[model samples]
Target: MNLRQIEIFQAVFAAGTASKAAVLLNLSQPAVSKAVQDLERSIGFALFDRSTGRMVPTAEGELFHREVEQTFAGLSRLRSSAARIRDFGSGEIRLASLSALSTNIVPKAIAAFRQRHPQVAITFQTQMSSTIRDLVAAGQFDIGLTSDEVDATGVTVEPFAIYRAAIALPEGHPLCAKPVLSPPDLHGEAFVALAPEDRTRQKLETVLAAAGAVPRIVLETPYSTTVCAMVQAGIGCGLINPLNAEPFLGRGLTWRPFEPALYFCTLLLTPPGRRGSRIAEDARTLLMSFAGERPALPADLHHVPEG
Candidate 1:
């Protein structure tokens, strides 16, 4: 009939007597008998054959209990699921980040976050700065990190970091002879450039132009990792984020400081005016802290704290 009636009926059926059912259910014997009578009358079934001191199940009762036990099994599972949701988290924290941070800083932050919230799910996506901006603006991602080249529109933005760039060179190249490279050193040398739209690339080009130096532009790409790989392959020497250069240092790759010291600017982005889950906020915090805690370099990091 009703859930309470079903509970009482199942208890009585399992215990096989009103007094025993009352003890199991923490109810009086009379109250248990009344509930059982109500359930039988509501369903119009004779569930128990009442003997002198015991209640015996009828054929109908035995068949009815088979289905009731299955329902209770499902109820038990729902209860366990509820407990799990309370102990852990319910949803995933979605993160959109640039490839520049994906390899080093972001992965470390994710690993740290997982140690505290082991059951919480995380989704990490790597894309260009512009795509990361769009994802944060549209609320497609819980948190985002992008290069300063991304326009500060639609989403809340703040200065993230301004890290110095280094020129990645193929090992044993002639330019490696120079302790540091000036625009003149790069003159007439084959070069791998970051995408033209990058502010860092534009700055490097401007410095070269002011010095009246030109390198043979052999290739261009959007990812710093690609720049490192291309330099390792001896495709051409390129200027890239030093954070991205560490992985390729001994694999036929080396780095030199560029004259006037170019730097890459970054921005931290999030959905404006929205309070996300604790998991997301904590993830963003961990990510920023990891960036700040990286080894000292020619870098200026701006850590923004929020609730």
Candidate 2:
């Protein structure tokens, strides 16, 4: 019999009378009686004893009800699962981000997301921008935060942020005197370079070359966090996304604006045709909230008061 028929039988059985079942089901008494009669005909057995003036369950009907109870138990579980998926997402969110954002902003966004949806599980990975693009395009990751340099051939792309590259330096460094710096200021200075393939690095190098500003290269790294650490360690100075410098600001590292502005463009990547699960999309919204919200730093970052 159909679930509607089974539902009618269940209501009639629970309520103990056709009139009561009609009140419970929001149907008329005659309709409820007809539905119970239809169920008995479909199953080829009477569910209620007709000899009694009041409704009473038959022995066979009681045995059949045990199975109906089990069926509804499973249906209850399905309803709960659907509720979770609709409200908190499909249980998990998988996200990958480039090191530039992963160092500071992405982690903050994730923390906020968790506070809002504590039940949603998150899989967060820090990879190169190109790798993030690849993962998103292949449908291996639900969302990707990457630099605009990655080829968008396989995934849908949108601008997430564009942080102006800043000059990261050790405290008390001489270059700190300038409110804003340009390629000429770094000439012959010790420089910690980003990896050769970095999109921002390529642009900065082009500007440095055109201006004949050749800083003495000290070390090379792919991560902006590492660049900040090296500058803190007195290894050298470098141009990095200021978002990566926030955690290091109080730890002996500082940053200043760079002129002829070089920007670290950030992109949001997702599978082209379809969107990600509810939790993943929720995380994407949180991440976008961090855009352009950098804390204001003092202009004379390197001029720490003698303490």
Candidate 3:
């Protein structure tokens, strides 16, 4: 039978009379009686005994009431879950990001978001820029943070932050004395470079070549954090994003701006056709705020790409 009929049956069974059921259900007595009658017709069975003035449940009615109670209980739970998701963002947010941001910036942003949306669940994955782009484009992730080098074909790319490349150095390094460094200052110095496929690495190589400066390449890595760690260990000085270099600044590591500044651009990526949930948008805004507030980077360098 229909939900309304089941509801009427349940009310009558609980209240023991159509008149009492009508008062409990906020319906007219005739409407309640008619609903019960319709339900009995639909089920091809009498659900109640009317031998006395009071309505009493039949054996079939008692069994049916049990199922109705369970059904309503399940519906109540479903509604509660839906309300939780609506009001508190209790649903999960799937996110992916580049390794550089995943290390510090993203984690800080997630912490801030959790302060506001404590019930929202988060799944964060760190991947290379291209992999982040692919995951977002394939709709596997709700939001993605990646470098501007990502292919924007099936994904929408928005600039989240920009940072000028800097020379990361260990404490007591001779180059730390320079206020602003150019590639020539690094000539013949040991260098920790990013992997060859990294766009920033290619740009650094171009700048170095143009300046006629060749640092002795000693190590190559895919992550800016690793570059910073290697620099802290005095393996070699490296060019890195200022955002990624912030956490290591006071921990026996320092950075200086590279003259004729080379820039590293970070972008937010999302599937082109999908609308992000409120929680996802909120998290993205927080991430942008964290990126904007990086004291190590210039204010003008921070930007949001056009829609």
lDDT of each: 0.84, 0.85, 0.83
What TM-score number comes out for model 1?
Answer: 0.80
The C-alpha RMSD in Å for every predicted model, in order, reads 5.9, 5.9, 5.9
Question: lDDT per residue, candidate 1, 104-208, as tens digits?
Answer: 989999999889887667889999899889999999998898999898789998777667787888988898777777899999999999999999999999999
lDDT of 2 by residue, 1-307 (tens): 7898889889988989988888998999889888888888989988899677767999989998999999999999889778879886587788999888876778889999989888677898999888888888888888999887789998999999887788998988998777678899999999999999889999999999999999999999988889989999999899888878887886788888888888888899998898577787888889999876864575455432211
Best-first order by TM-score: 1, 3, 2
Top lDDT prediction, candidate number: 2
Candidate 2: list runs displaced more than 4 Å.
1-78, 87-89, 302-307
- List candidate 1 segments past 4 Å from native: 1-18, 29-90, 294-307
- How do these models rank on lDDT, best leading? 2, 1, 3
Would you list the clashing residue pairs of candidate 2? none
Tell me how many clashing residue pairs each candidate has. Answer: 0, 0, 0
**Whole-structure CA lDDT of model 1:** 0.84
Give all TM-scores, in the order shown: 0.80, 0.72, 0.74
Instruction: Give the CA lDDT, 0 to 100, for residue 143 in model 3.
Output: 88
The Cα RMSD in angstroms, rounded to one decimal, for candidate 2 relative to the true structure is 5.9
Better of 1 and 2 by lDDT: 2
